[model samples]
Target: MFASGASRRCFLLIVFLLCAIMSRSGVQGGANLCSVDFEVFGNVQGVCFRMYTEDQAKKLGVSGWVKNTRQGTVVGQVQGPTDKVREMKVWLSKVGSPSSRIDRAVFSNERDIPKLEMRGFGTRY
Candidate 1:
């Protein structure tokens, strides 16, 4: 029993040290970091879509930039935890601002990233 207790304590200590190291290195606790670029089509422009996207991304702890495309679409790249990025994608596809109509959400250029490229969500001109 004493040996088991000692082994468990050692394991916990190792995990704690690894967590501290990852934190100092600016990495989430075993969470994958990734980026995805998406474009929303149909009635997305001039409807506060970008603002809403920024808000959602910030709420989800996603770091990236969003912009309005001249082609009447909203385009953006989001980088963060895989789960949070997926959540953001769902939000963009289904619940985009109260005023905007999201017809189609197409995602592309998604890949694992070493780190976040942006600090917070922002609307790009």
Candidate 2:
């Protein structure tokens, strides 16, 4: 309902300011950067869990590293847009691989990071 020229100008200014603020907060429109450390337990090893994780992460546009722990667990970090990271979490908790059973998924140290640390998803070793 901006009828006058001055009113339209004011509306545009407000829109611009809002965009600038959102960009500065690691949020570009609806996207935001996030990071989380995760540990997966249960029959995760010997089933190509890391490979499946890398595949899923790349599909979802999340970047990080996954590696098999000495304690028979899988540990890794995931960093990406908030929505993509959440999707990755869901995948980790439910669908690990066709042959593996996920008993527990421990997520911790989750927070909004400044930026992504990895370029693409890959297995560390």
Which number leads on TM-score? 2
TM-score of 2: 0.80
Error of 1 at 31 (Å): 2.5
The root-mean-square deviation over C-alpha atoms between each candidate and the true structure, in angstroms, is 4.6, 4.3
Tens digits of per-residue lDDT for model 1, 11-122: 8999999888886665755568899999999898888999899989989989999999889999999999888999999999999999999999999999998777779889
Candidate 1 backbone collisions, by pair = none
Which stretches of model 2 miss by more than 4 angstroms? 1-7, 10-30
Give a tens-digit lDDT track for model 2, residues 32-115.
789999999999999999999999999998999999999999999999998889999999999999999999999999998767
Q: Relative to the unseen true structure, what is the Cα RMSD of model 2?
A: 4.3
Query: Can you give the TM-score per candidate against the true fold?
Result: 0.79, 0.80
lDDT value for candidate 1? 0.90
